[model samples]
Structures are given as C-alpha cells and as structure tokens.
Target: MARQVSLATQLAQSPSAWNGHIAPLILRAMTDVYITLAWIFQDREKRTDEYVKYGLGQRKLWLEHFKRSLVERGEKEPEKNLFVKALTRQLNAERFEHITEVNVGAWSERSTRKMAEEAGCLDLYRLAYTPFSTAVHSMWTHIAGYNLRRCRNPLHQFHRVPEDSDLEPDIDYVYRAAKYVAKTFALFDRETGVSVETPSSLDQFVESLAHPTGEAQTDSPDPLDDL
Candidate 1:
C-alpha cells in the first residue's frame, strides 16, 4: 500500500526547507545531562538506597560510551584531537567550578554576557536564552520524575516550588553548568562559521574550523603530532 504524502513531509524533503531540527536536538541532548544529574541528586535526598548505585552505574556506562566515541575520532585526526582536548578541558573546568558559577548567579551572568559580547554573539545569546531556560526546566522535570518514582510526594504537590527557588541549589547549579557548555560551543560555532551539516563527526568539526573555506589543505603530517 502506498503511504499518503503530507505537505509537511514534502516541505521537509525540500533542499532549502530551512529546517531548524539540529538546534533543538543539540539543546535537548545537552539539557539531558542536567536532567540525569537532577535525578541522581533527588534520589540521594530521598534516601533511595538503590539510586546512587543505579545512577552511578548508568553514568559510568554513558560516560564510557561518550568518551570512547570522542577518542576514536581524536586518534585519527589532529584537528579533532585539539577540539576534543579543548572540550575536555572546558567541561572539566565547569565541573570543578560547578554550574552555578557559570549559569544563574550575578557574577556568572555578567561574565557570560561579557564573553558573548566579546565574541560578537549577542544574537546567539538572545536566541539561546530560551533554550537555556528550557534546559533548566528539563532539569526540574528530572527532579520531579525522581520524586514521583519514589512515591514521596506527588508532582502536583511540589509544583508551587519555583525553579530558581533556594530549595534546590544543587540542581540549579547542574543546569547552569550544562548551559555554560552549550553557550560556549554555540559561540565557537558562530565565530568559526563552521557548517554543521556535513561535519557530524568530531574530526569534521575540527577540520572545518582548522581549515575554513578557501584555505589550503596541507599534505604534511597531522598538526597535533606532538600531542
């Protein structure tokens, strides 16, 4: 049987559809990190004995898979290695300093805004604000999910608690940290003017930045040989 075609499908099939699909997905993926962390923290508060064990197990598996994928590409390409290194450094710094330092607090906001202005990304800043806020909401949802799963209190009962309330500073911190990383990457992409379509791979991302359009591709050894 032939499937019925819809106008939406036809529009999606068009080459110039201007579909903004990737933006949402990127935001979601980054936000998921905060959501997962919120669950871990909420479970801890509830004294759910299995929460830590299960959550840590899940986190280990997820991090292993993510690191393996990043490392594989880094091994084959110099430019990719540099990007992976830089990303690792940034993530580590954020993790150490905590997300509150990067997200919602007055100092954090001032610093972030300054960086965005310096990078000439005020437009990206405006566009990403809602996505960043959405990510924070996703984190709250995760916390709510944990509370519901534990049967401690119904989600509706807790609905009155504002997201930025002083009740859950840790969760807010996690959300802020995640947003900081996203904002940084978005700024990098904007400044480099890298095309996100073809370069889905880490190697391609690094290569595109290292070798922008109209630049000569070198035949020499990998630039990251020393690393």
Candidate 2:
C-alpha cells in the first residue's frame, strides 16, 4: 500500500485533476497486484507461450499505428522513417509475420472479474474497483454522486459544477487500499525471501481512523491562558 499511501499524501499536498488520476490507477493496480500473486502461487510457466504471443501481437499493433502516422505525414517510405530503434524492426520478418497469424486480440481475454476470481480478490474488486470504474469512465453515477449538491435556500435547489475540491470519498476506501497494500507487501516478502515488516503506525493509523474523536486536542499545560 505504499502506492495508496503515496497517492493519499499527494492528494493532501496538492489536490488537482492530474493527481486525482491516482484514484483510478490505484484501483487498477490493486487488481493487477492480486492477479500477479495468483500467477506466482500457480505455475506461471504454463502460460509462457500465450504471453509471448500476446506481447508480439501488441508490438505489431503499435508498429502498425506508427506506420499509419508516418503515412499520414506523407512520408514516401515509412520503413526508413524510424528515428528510434524499435523491437519491431529488429525482429525477424518471418517471426514478425506471425503477429498476423494470432487473431485473439491485443488485450487479455480475461475480464476484471475473472482476474479477481483467480487472484482471490473478488470481494475487493466489487467493493473498490467496480465503484472506482465509474470515475474512470466518467459515468453519470459518479457525476451525480460527487458534483451534484443542493443549494442552501428555502426552495432547496440543485447545482452542478465542473469540479469540486471539497469532495472527499468515504474513508473506507482508503482503509481497503491500505489493507490491499499490506497484503501485497507481505506476499512479495514471502515470495522473494525478504524479511520486511510492516510498520506498527499503519495499524495504529487504521485504528484511529475507525474511532475518530475529531480534531486533535492541544497539549498546552495552561489551557485557559490561551483563550
């Protein structure tokens, strides 16, 4: 949860749309982390050929797009327009031709739910990732939840704005992210033969979050003197 913590810190330091991008990214990464653990727990070698095929297909698709860009610029010879040395050019033409042979598509066939099920994180996916997807997709659900607010008037009117800096998501999501991060780190340590320990403060912080007593109390001995 280093990533989640870092994102939270970033949001606190400088709240903006660019920094807010971290929310969706963190959700996406959580799923990926779980899938990675699943792959590690299972025998990943069984999927080597398929992964390699997927990689090559992705490379070919990228090169095709690059070639199209060159053509649009009216470059007579797209092949000679390569300023940067790319893997597509280095690959044997025969093997590269196999990119066309694979028709499964560039992206993984597995859905987020499938990956989550395999990774044993389907609950987290439903609780966190699915809700976060609304923000990522700019759906009306997110718009209504975050931006729509009632005006302070006797008539009780509603208004929408382009952005809302005061919008803070429920703290439950933060706790969930932290928990995922802790679990991921523990998994990494176990798999890599590392002996890192999570800090006690993380647990304390989560505990404090659950039982908030409002703003911190002042420590001055003469409490009435300041008033």
Candidate 3:
C-alpha cells in the first residue's frame, strides 16, 4: 500500500501533462491498495475460504472466457488447443469438474465491502473507494461529472471540453490518498501484531491538508488519526 501510494504521489507531483487521465488511475490504484489491505487485515486467519474461492472463481472465469473465444475463432484445433488445455488443467488441478462449478452455487458472504466493514474501514470505501470504482469503469457518473460542462439551460447545455482543457491538477487529492494509505498501513500493522510508526511529518501533513487554517471542514476525521 505504501509503495502504491508513493507512486501515485509521484504521478500527482509530476507535470500536469496528464492530470485529467492520470488522476483517476491514481485514485483507482489507491482504492485497490486500500481494499487489498483491508482484506488482509480482516481475514488473516485462513483468509476466509470464501475469498480464496472467489479468487479461484475469477481465474476459472477468465480461463473459460479464453477457451470460448478460441473455439469461436476456430483456433481450438488439437495442435492449437493451448487455451483449452490450460482450462482443463486448471480445473483438474483445483479438483473442479468445470468452470461452472467454480462460479455457480452459494458464494462467500464476505465481499470487498464486507471486508471493509469487518475491518472498521467502511467509511473509506464509501468516501473514496466506491467513487474511484466508477472512474475505473468509465461509468456515466464519472463521465458526466468530469467531461461535461454544467449550464443553466436544460436542453443542449452540456458541452464537452476540448482535450487541452482537461481537469486542473488537484494536490489535495494526493494528500488525502496519502492519508488513506497511512491509515490502511496502520490498520494492517496493528492487526498483524506489528507496530506502525509513521514519519514525524505524516500526521501534521494530513491534518494540514484536511483542515486548512481558518477553514471549517465538515468531514468527520478518521478515527485512526488519533493513533
């Protein structure tokens, strides 16, 4: 998580040449790191068989998709049946009859959101992780917010800005991402019996960004900040 956040910080600090395109990428990376850490912290013991099952299911799904595409393209001949062989081998290794078995039936109750809830970091998922997901998927929610201009007239008022006029750089986001990384690191450390030691400046930097002097921020502070 620390390394991922560090890379995002570097990208954010670099020239604003790709701010519009890169910011979302950074946000998604941060969100992934946050969720992955939360999962590790919440399921250290046996890591919840469901999570393992979910991962195996994902692998099976991809392999099955690949096999189907190969068959459709007429590339499933005995000599060129690499993907089919791979799928079969994977299923056999996992002791599953087919990909359908891996994907079907009752799944684990523990989801990404559930991990966050169990880890006491659901607010982080709600505030940042979910929004970042839309950005990652290029959903209309992200497109309409960042790409379209707001106007008074309801009809034909929205105009897409030129490529050159992309989003301005936002340093505040970098700070918040860093803070989330720090908190996630602490959570994992505490859960794993490791003492988290942040740099002397980390708390002050996060606080300064969170509450600029003389400005009242309504956002509730992270409880982990006290640590």
Highest lDDT model number: 3
Error of 1 at 108 (Å): 25
Candidate 1: C-alpha lDDT: 0.40
Off by over 4 Å in 1: 1-22, 34-204, 212-215, 219-227
TM-score of 2: 0.60
Off by over 4 Å in 2: 1-22, 87-108, 148-177, 189-227
Better lDDT candidate (1, 2): 2
- Residue 29, candidate 2: alpha-carbon lDDT: 61
Worst 10 residues of 1 by lDDT: 1-10
lDDT of 2 at 136: 75
lDDT of 2: 0.59
TM-score of structure candidate 3: 0.62
Per-residue error (Å), model 2, residue 163: 4.3
Candidate 2: how large is its RMSD? 7.3
lDDT per residue for candidate 3 within 1-227, as digits (tens), equals 55665765676467572454556667667766676666665556555556567667767777767766777888746325765677667667876535434645334445667767876778878888787778778788777776665554568566455232466777766665566666666766677788745563457676786688867556766577679
**Clashing residue pair totals per candidate (backbone < 3 A):** 0, 1, 0
Please report, as a residue range, the 10-residue window in candidate 3 with the lowest summed lDDT: 97-106
* Candidate 2 residue-wise lDDT, 83-124, digit = tens: 423545555453664444443552346776776687676876
Report the C-alpha lDDT of model 1 over 1-227, residue by residue, as the tens digit.
Answer: 00111222233244342223223334444333323332333334542344333433444444446667866766544324665457556545535312222222322123444444544544545665445544445555544533233323576554343332222222222233334454444434554575455422334434565787867566865577679
Instruction: Say which candidate scores most in TM-score.
Output: 3
